[model samples]
Target chain A: MRLISTYLIGLVFGLGIMISGMANPAKVLNFFDFAGTWDPSLIFVMGGAVTVAFIGYRIVLARPAGTPLMEAKFNIPSNRALDGRLIGGSAVFGIGWGIAGFCPGGALPAVGTLNADVLIFMAALVAGIFAAKALQTLTANRAAKATA
Target chain B: MITEFTPYQSLAGGVLIGTASVLLMLTLGRIMGATGILAGFFRPMSLEDWTWRAALLAGMVTAPVLMLAVSGQMPPIQVPISKTMMIVGGFIVGLGVTFGSGCTSGHGVCGMARLSPRSIAATITFMIFTAATVYVVRHVFGG
Candidate 1:
C-alpha cells in the first residue's frame, strides 16, 4: 500500500515536471538569469507547489493524535540551526543549477524523453554523488585526526 | 532569443507536483526527496527499502514516455551547454545535492512545505549563487 501510493505520486510529480516546461533547460535558466533575459515563469511553479504543500501539511499534521496518520510521524525536518554545510553546499548546488538549469526532479524525466545529453548528465550526476560521499568521509577523517 | 513564459502551464504543473508530494507523505510517511531517492547507491544506510524507491523511480521515468504516447510528441527540453559542459554540470549537481542534503525536491518542495529554517536558508543561498552564476557565465564569459 505504501509503495503503491508513493509510485502513483511519483508518476504525478514526473508529469508535472514535464508539463511545466521544467524539463526544458533553457526555460529553467531564464528563471535564474535575474540580470539577463530573465524569465519569471518558473517562480509560479514554486508558488503553486508551496501553497498546496503549506495547506496540505497543516491539515495532515492536524489529524487526531491516535489516528493512523499520527502513528507514522511525518518525515519533516526539525533542525533550525543555520550551518556551514547547509549554506556552502547549497551555494555549490546553485552554481551547478545555474550552469545546467537541471535539478534531480526536473532532470530525471528528460531521460524518458530520450535526451542523450540528459543521459550523460545523469551518468555524471551518479559519479558526483559517489564523489560527494568520498569527500564527506575525507572531511570527517580530517576532523577526527585534528581532534586526536 | 527566448520563448514566451507559460504561466498557466507551469502553475498547473506545480500544483500536480505539490499534490504528489502531499500524497506521498500521507501514505508512505516519508518525504519525497528526489536526490536521495535517485542517488540510491550512495545511501550510507541500508538498501532493504528499495521497493518504494524503485517503484517511484519507474513511475517518474515512465512519465515522459506516457506523454509521448498521449501526444505523439516529446516535451521541449532545452540544453544550455555542450556535451562536455553538461557532464561537468551534472557532476556538480550530483555532488552539491549530496553535500547540501537535498536538491529542488527535498529542500525546495518538502522542506519549504514543512517550514524548516535550514531549508529556507539553503534555498536563499542557492538562489543567490544560481542567479550570480548565470550573470557571470552569460555576461562576463559571454556565453
Candidate 2:
C-alpha cells in the first residue's frame, strides 16, 4: 500500500515536472540565462510549488501527532545548522545545473524519453553518487586516523 | 531570442508537484527529494525502504507515457549540451546533492515551504552559482 501510494505520488510529481517544461534542458537553460532569452517561467513554478506545499504541510503537521497513514512518524529532517557542506555542495550542484540544465528531479522523468544523452547523464549521475560515498568514507577514515 | 514565458502551465505543474509532496507526507511521512530518493533506491537501508523507492522510481521513469496520454504526445526533451558536458554536469550535480543533502525539490520547494534557514541559504547559494555558470557559459565563453 505504501509502495502504491509512493508510485502514484511520484507519477504526479513527474507529470508536474513535465508540464512545467522543466524536463527540457533547453528550457531550463533559458531560465538561467539572464542576459540572453530569460524565461521567467521556472520562477513561477517554484512559487506555485512553495505556496501550495507551505499550506499543505501546515495542515498535515497540525493533524494529531502520529497522523501519517502508513508511517509511524514523520521523517522530516531537523538539521538546522548552516554548514560548509551544504553551501559548497549547493554551489557545486548549481554549476553543474547551469552547465547541463538537468537537475536530478528534471532528468529522472526525461529518462522516459529514452534519449541517449539522458542515459549518459544518468550513468554519470550514478557514478557521481558512488564517488561521493567513497569520498565521504575516505574523509571519515582520515579524520579517525588523525584523532587516533 | 526572447524565451517563451509559460506562466499557467508552470504554475499548474508546480501545484501538482506540491500535491505529490503533500501526499507523500500524509501517507509515508517522507520528504520528496529527487536525489535523496534516487540515492536511497540505489543503496537501500532495508527491504521495506527499497520497495517504495523502487515504486516511485518506476513511476518517474514511466512519466513520458503519462505525458503522451495527457498532452497527446511525449513531452519534448532537449539536451542542449554535448555528451561530454552532460557527463561532467551530471557527476557534479550528483556529488553536490549528496553533500548538500537535498536538491531543488527537497530544498527549493519543501524546505522553503517549511521555512528552513539552512534550505534558504543553500537555495540562495545554488541559485547564484547557477546564474554565474550560465553567464559564463552563455555570455563569456559563448558556448
Candidate 3:
C-alpha cells in the first residue's frame, strides 16, 4: 500500500513537470531571465502548488499520527532559526540552479523525457553530491584532528 | 516579472504537483524532497526501507514514457549548456541542498506550507541570488 501510493504520486508529479513545461531547461532558464525573455508561468505553478499544499499539510498534520493515512512519524524539519550556513548555502545553490536551470525535484523525473542535457545534469549531480559529502567529511576530520 | 504567462497549463500542472505532495505526505509520512530521497537511495539501507524509494523512482522514470505512449508525443527538452558548466552547477546544487537542508519541493512547497521560518528564509535567500545570477549571466556574461 505504501509503495503503491508513493509510486502513484511520483507518476503524477512527473507528468505535471512535463505538462507544465518545466521539464525543459530552456523554459526554466527563461523563468530566471528577467532582463531578457521572461516567462512568468512558473510563478503560477508555484502559487497553485503552494495553495493546495498549504491546506493539505494542515489537514495531514492535524491527524493524531502527525500525518493522515500513514502510520509513520512525520519527517519534517524542526529547525526554525535562520543561520549563516543556511543563507550562504542557499545563495550559492541559487547560482547553480540558475546556471543549470535544474532543481533536484525537477531534475529527477525528467530522466523519462530522455534528454541528453537532463542525463548529463543527473550524472554530474550524482558525482557532485558524493563529492560534497566527501569534502564535508574531510573537513570534519581535519577539524577533529586539529582539536586532538 | 511578467512575460509569457501560461496560466491554465501551469495551474493545472501545479495542482497536480500539490496533490502528489499531499498524498505522499499523507500516505508515506515522508517529505517529498527529491534531492534527499535520491541521495538516500544510493546510500545503504535495509531492503524494507529501500523498496518504496525504488518503486517511487520507477514511477517517476516511467511517467513520461507512459504519457508519450498514450498521447503520441512528448515534450522537448533542449539545454545548450557546456559539460564544465554542468559539473560545476551540479556540484553547487548538491552542496547547497545539504547545507540548506532542502530544495524546491522540500523548502518551497512543503516547508512553506507548514509555515517553517527556516524554509522561508532559505527560499528568499535562493530567490534573491537566483535573480542576481540570471541578471549577471544574461547581461554581464552574455550567457
Best model number under lDDT: 2
Which scores better on lDDT, 1 or 2? Answer: 2
Q: CA shift at A78, candidate 2, in angstroms?
A: 1.2
For model 2, the superposed segments whose C-alpha errors exceed 4 Å read B1-3
lDDT of 1 at A62: 76
lDDT of 3 at A143: 100
Residue B28 of model 1, lDDT score: 61
Judged by DockQ cut-offs, the docking class of candidate 3 is: medium
User: Can you write out model 3's per-residue Cα lDDT over B16-75, one digit (the tens) per residue?
Assistant: 888788888888777777777888888847786677778778788887898889989876
**Deviation (Å) of B10 in candidate 1:** 0.1
lDDT minimum window of 10 residues, candidate 2 chain B:
B1-10
- C-alpha lDDT values of all predictions: 0.82, 0.88, 0.79
On DockQ, the leading prediction is 2
Query: What's each prediction's TM-score?
Result: 0.93, 0.97, 0.93
Model 1 spans > 4 angstroms off? A65-71, B41-44
- Write down the worst ten-residue block by lDDT for model 2 chain A: A61-70
The residue-level lDDT of candidate 2 at A4 comes to: 80
Off by over 4 Å in 3: A65-68, A146-148, B1-4
User: B4-102 in candidate 2: lDDT tens per residue?
Assistant: 789999999899889988888899888888988999989999999999998888888778887787778887777778999999999999899889988
Displacement of the residue B50 alpha carbon in candidate 2, Å: 0.5
Error of 3 at A34 (Å): 1.5
lDDT of 1 by residue, B50-108 (tens): 76778788788889899999999888887868888788788998888888888888889
